[model samples]
Structures are given as C-alpha cells and as structure tokens.
Target: MNEKLLNNTACAMVAPGKGILAADESTGTIEKRFKSINIDNTEPNRQAYRDMLFTTAGAEAFISGAILFEETLFQSALDGTPFSKLLASKGVIPGIKVDKGAKPLAGAPGETVTEGLDGLRERLVKYREAGARFAKWRAVITIGNGIPSAYCIETNAHALARYAALCQEADVVPIVEPEVLMDADNTIEICEKVTSDTLQAVFDQLYLQRVLLEGMILKPNMVISGKKCPTQADVSTVAAATLRTLKHHVPSSVPGIAFLSGGQSDEVATAHLNAMNEMGGGPWALSFSYGRALQAPSLKAWGGKVDNVADAQRAFHHRAKMNSLASLGQYNDSLETVA
Candidate 1:
C-alpha cells in the first residue's frame, strides 16, 4: 500500500504556507460557475481557464496540490503538456475527485449521501497510473429543520471511510470531506454541533474501516454560522469555534485538516484561516481546500476574454498568496491592499 508515500503526500498537501486548490469542479458544476460570468462552458474554455490557473507565475509557491476532475486529469496545457504533468513539474501533487455526486437519501427528507463507491478501487488504480497521488470524496450534511438525521450522518460517514480505505489500499492519500452546509438559518452553535457530530462519526467509521489516519487529510467545513443567520460570526470567533470542534473530534493522528470554503467569501475565508493560524497550538496543520472561495476572483477577472489572461492569473496568484500567508499566520488587512 506504500504507507510512507501516502503519509508523505498527505503531509505535503498541508505543508507550511501551502494549501490545495480545488479545481475539481465537474462539468455541470463548472457550467454554473461559468454561467455567472456569461462564458460558454465549452471544452476549450474550460481548458483555457484551467491552463491559466496552472500556468500562473508563482502559484506553486502557495498551491501544494490541485484536485482535478476526471476530464481535467487527462487534459493537456495549451502547449500540449498533460495537466497532471504540468502540475507535477511545478512541485504540485495531482489529485482526483472520485465521488460521483450527492443524491437524495431515502427516508431522510432534505438530506443526501455522496455516491461513487461502486468501482472506486479500479478507478483509483487508473488515477494512480495517471499520476494522481491523492483523491477526494465529499459527503454533504445539510443543516435544516428537523434534519441531518442520525441515519444520514452514519450512512455518509460509512461511505467516506470505505472510500478512504480504498484510496489507501491504492496508495492514494484520501481527502475525506464531510461538509455541514451553511445554507440554513441555523446559528453558529447549531453549525458547531453539526460539524462536531459529523466529524466524530467520520473518525469512528475511519477507525472501523482500518483506514490509516496519517495517510488521509480531513476536508471539513469550518464551524461557522449559517448564511441566513442574523448574527454572522467574526473572524476570531469562527476560528476559535472551528479549532475547538476540530481539536475535540479530529484525531491528532491525522496529518492536517484542509477546510472547505463551503460558502464563505474569499476574504472572509482567508481571514478566518489567518485567525486560526494566529491562535496556533493545534496538533495538526490547518489549511484550506477551497473551490469557489479560491476561484471566484480569478473567474471574474478572466470573464471569458483572451486579453484578460494575465489579469486572471494575477487575481489567482493574489488569492493563493493570501491564503498562503494565512496558512503561516502572516496575513493581515494591510496585505490585502498591497499590489
């Protein structure tokens, strides 16, 4: 299983001053993102957009790894270099998103379970051969009225553990993600409770499945208030709550926790992470594995224009650099105004 390789890769994914870039949006998902900018979601556009991000000068300084979708794994740069090869050349680990998507769970209203374990072992073999050293599987836990049932949490945790086992068996570090969605009107306390329970369940299943904790990175939602909540948490408050929940639930054996942006604005996400790092003292490294929070600015700058490539890349580099500084507790509002 190459345990050393898995552990080393997992550690590198959250190395000091670095984090993962979640460029693994599926076709449908990227389509929605592209639609927002009035860009046609064509193959060429997708390739170009990703190419821009990958080729951005100095991005490798902050981006330790890039999680790719299936198509992106095989796609090439404008110069014909494979995306995986391009990223590897820049000292970035290549990872794949293995989950099919979330589906409605029967008997659990307003809940979902992430699918795609049907042929994961075989797929992992293929992804490994294609230069992927890690993989991600996400399980969504919605917070709503009378929901996030025990059944739903258990079912998703079991799936995540199974997927992690498969990934480790194939020598691929797994990013086990159990996101407690922030789409509800719930308070920060409710978010904390849900995130804590979901993480505890995930670790329990990971133990039961015999997954190597050191060979996996946890991608969890930060303990924060819901979008519709009256009182949004301040940066320091969110950081403290997130660290408290993580320290209580996540085993120290795990190499790191790479937080999903969920629905946080780019600045807000970076601020929260910076606050956490400033507090320090966690057993494992804390970093980001953001999608929209990382990509939104770049996408807006690109705006489907060839002339905007440099601007898009600059925007991407700025965000990545901000998160990089945040990872080391060096970011501040002053840095935001620079350049």
Candidate 2:
C-alpha cells in the first residue's frame, strides 16, 4: 500500500464540515425512490435523478466525498462529464459500493452475509482507474429474540475485513460499516450490546486481516432502541450510549466514526449526531454518512419538477449544513431554515 495514497484517501473521506453523500443505492433501491416520486425507474431516469442530486451546486461545500453505485461510477452526466470527473473537479472524492448485495446466510435462517469478496481485488483496481479514492461495503445485523447469533456477526465482520484489506492494498480507503438493524422491539440496552459485539468482531477481523486501522473509517449505526420499542432513548441517552460503546470497543487508532442514519428522520439523525459530538472526547470523530435521512427532504422538495431544483438544492444544502455543524457539535435548528 502506498502510504500517501492511503492517508489521502482517509483524509478525503473524513474531512471536517463535510460528510459523505451515499448516492450508491442499488437499482432496485433507486427504483423505490423513483416510485415515490412517480418517475419511471428506467436507466436514463435513474441516471437523471442521481445526476440531479450529484450535480447540485455547492454540494461540495458540505460533502467531501460521494459513495456511488457501479453504474454511476462509469456513467457520464447529461453534459458528458463522468460522475467521477465532476466530483474530482469540485474537490470531492468519489467512492464505490462494491458489495454484490447481501445474501441470506446458509443455516442461519433470517440473517445475511454480504457477498463481493469474489474478484473484489480486480473490481477495486478498475474503480481506482476510474478515479474512485475510497469504497464502502455494508453488513446488516438484525436484532430479535435469540437472533444474530455469533456465527452471523462473525461471517459479516470477516467479509468486511476482507474487503477492507483489498481496498487498502489498492490504495483505497475502506468505509467499514456493520449496521445493526433497528427492526425489532428491543431496548436501548439491547442495541448497545449488539453494536458493541458487532464492532468488537469487526475490528478483530480487521486485525486478523492485517488491515491498517489509520487508513480506514468506521461507519456504524448509532446505538438506539428499536423503532418499535416502547421506550425511546433521549438524545443525551442515545449519545452517551453510543459513545460509551465505541469507547469500550473501537480503538483510538481508527480515525473517525461517521454514522449511518438507519430509518431516522433527517433532523432526528442530525440531532443525534450533534448530541454525540457535543458530549465530546470519544475515541473517534462522530459525524454522518446518511442516505434516506439526508436525501428524503431534498427529494420531496424537488417533487420531480425542474422548477423545484433551486428549492431542492436549498433543502439539501440546509440538511448538509446542519449535519456539518452537528459534526462540530454546534448545530442550532433555529438557524436551519435561514441558513
């Protein structure tokens, strides 16, 4: 691994006041987004929608990097510039999501194991040639009664580490994400336990794979109760729980921890990140790498109308700006609208 390249990749992904934009939705997922807006889910339509989001003016101000799908990485904008070139021109690093979708684990009934290790090295090489500086792979962990057995967590963690090692070898920073789903009626304590166990296993595999800790970013779900839990954790409680869990598990060698806003409302996700940063002095930098939580409002503002582009940009900018401030623990909702 080239030292400078690895470090540069890491820096680009975790630059301050600027987080990552997860525009890497799979075709089916993008189709779902298109369905909500009544747009056809054809290739050109999907490209156009992503083009609209990626080409938003000044998004580079709050977005240091963009995580993209294989299609977007190779596709050109309507103006003929490749998405990677557009991002590079604006000083934003481009990344790719390499996992070949999650497959149901064998003998583990409802759990999943992420696939992509096969030929990942070659894919990483091609992505780098196409100007991607980093990459992401998401591993899902579900919570429930007697579920997410050790076998399930370890399988996913091993894949994440394997992917990370390959990325580092190709001089690409890996955004290691092991997200524990909030799909059950579990308590905050359960979320904490699961998150802790997941990270512990993730890092252990990273160690076994001899992946460099400094050259990677850890993106994990914040420890909060299940969506259907009777009692919800307050912002402070959520922040404290998340920090305590990371403090006990993730080492200080890892540079930062940008969160995935799994099923959170835009403001709610930003508020949680803000609270975590406000608490301060944890092992890693707490920021965001949100998808739906960040894009939903902007997409709504757009309403698929060309005339609403400015409004959409404004809404997108607002959320990004808020999250940027929250990354520094200084966000104020009163300023959200005006800013």
Candidate 3:
C-alpha cells in the first residue's frame, strides 16, 4: 500500500471548503432521476448529463473529487474527452463505485448487504489504470422493528472492511459507507443506536482486516430522525448526535468523515453539515459526499433541454458553492437566494 499516496488522496477528498460529488448513480438509479426530468435514459443522454456537470465552471473550486459509476468511468464527453480525464484536467480526483447493489441478507428478513467483492482486486486495477484514484462501496442497513440485527450489521461491516483492504492494496482510497436508511417512522434515538452499532462493527472489522485507517475515508449517514418520523430533529440536534456517535466509534486515525446525505433535501443536508462544522474541533474533517442533495436542483434546471445547459451548470455551481461554505461552517440562509 502506498501509504503516503493513499493518505494524500484521502485528505484531498475531504479538503476544507471542498467535498466529493457523488455522481455514481447506477444506470437504474439515474434512469429514475431522468424520469423525473422527462429525459430519456439513453447512454448518450446520461453521458450528456454528466458532461454538463463535469464541465460546470468553478466546480473545481468546491469539488475535490467525483465518484463515478462504472459506465461513466469509461464514458466520454460530447467533445470526445474521457470523463475521468476531464475531471483530472480540472484538478478533481476520479473515483468509482465498486460494489454491486445491495442484496437480501440470507436468513435475515428485511435486511440487505452490499456485494461485489468477487474479482474486486482485478476491477480496482482496471479502474486505477482508467484514472480512478478512489472507490466507494455502500452497505444498506434498514431500521425497523426487529430488523438490522447483529447478523446483518456484521455481514455488511465485514464486506466493507474486505473491500477497503483490497482498495488500499490496489492503491485506491476506499470510502467505507454503511448507510442506515432513514425511511421509517423511527425517532432520532433509534437512528443513533443503529448508526453507532453499525459504525462500531465497521471499524472493528477494518482493524481486524488491517486496513490502514489513515488511507481510507468514512462516508457515513448523519444521525438524524427518519423521513417518516412525525417530528424530525432540528439541525443542531442532528449535528450533535451525529458527532457524539462518530466520536464514540470512529478513530482519529481516519483522515475524514464524508457524510452521505441519505434522503435529505438539498438545503436541509447543507444545513446539517453547516451546523456540524459550526461545533468545530472534531477528530476528522466533517464534509459531504452527496448525490441527490448536490444534483437535484441542477437536474431540475437542466430538464433535459439542450438550451438549458448553461442554466444547469449555474445551478450546479451554486449548490456546490453552498455545500463548500457549509463545510467551513460559513453558510447561511441568505446565500441560498444570492444566485
């Protein structure tokens, strides 16, 4: 493992005032996003959408890295430039999503684990050669009555650790993600317990596997109320709980904690992150690795129209800039209306 290179890349991923752009939606996932905008889900359209994002002016100022889908890793821009190269040319690191979608965990009803470890080393080599310096693998943990059992959590954590080890071995920084779904009516307390347990297991497995902690990033869900909860926790409450949970579990050796905006609205996600940074003095950098929270407005602005390319890019830049400020605890509501 090129320890120094891994540490550099991992730190760069969570650089102050910058974060990762998770453009790594699977084909099916992007198709659903396109469906909302009335755009065809053709390869060319997908390529065009990403091209607009990658080419957005001033994005490099806020976007340190972009996590790409397997297909997008090999895709090219409208002008025939490889997407990976385009990002690198602008000083953004390229990353790939290495895990296949989550699957049902055996004997564990209503829970799932992420797959795709088979042949992952080979795939990592190819991705690195293709200009990817990092990779992401997400494990889904559903919170419901009697769900997310120890078996389910351990299974996914084990998979995440193995994947991280492989990534470091192949010279790629792994973003270890174990997302606790916020789709239930659970309160913030429930989310916190699950998140805490999930993280503890993940880190324990990472240690057992001997994955270099400083060389990988932790992309985790912020402790917050569930989407269906009658009363949601406020920004400060969520931030404090998330910090407490992470501080209790994640080691200081990790370079940073890049949060996944799991089902959060764009503004709310930014607000939560801003609140966390406002508290200050954490073991690692608290940043973002958001997908919908970062791209929803841009997609709406684009609306799949060729003439809206400039509008889309503007919207993209605006969102990225807001999150960038949020990373530094300098964001406010007034900035939301500036553009």
Each prediction's whole-model lDDT (CA)? 0.94, 0.89, 0.95
Candidate 3 overall lDDT versus native: 0.95
List pairs with backbone clashes in candidate 1: none
Off by over 4 Å in 2: none
- Candidate 1, residue 73: the lDDT equals 98
What is the C-alpha lDDT profile of model 3 across 1-339, one tens digit per residue?
A: 999999999999999899999999999999999999988999989999999999999999999999999999999999999999999999999999999989998899899989899999999999999999999999999999898899999999999999999999999999999999999999999999999999999999999999999999999999999999999999999999999999999999998999999989999999999999999938899899999999999999999888999998998999999999999999997899626
Evaluated against the true structure, the overall lDDT of model 2 is 0.89
lDDT of 2 by residue, 1-339 (tens): 986778767866777787888989999998888789887778887677677787888878888888999999999887999999998998889999999988999999889999999999999999999999999999999997798899999999999999999999999999999999998999999999999999999999999999999899899999999999999989889999999999999989887888999998888899999988888848666778999988998887776777887788778877888899998889876776734
Candidates sorted by lDDT, best first: 3, 1, 2
- Backbone collision count in every prediction? 0, 0, 0
Using TM-score as the yardstick, the better of models 1 and 2 is 1
Cα-based TM-score, every candidate: 0.99, 0.97, 0.99
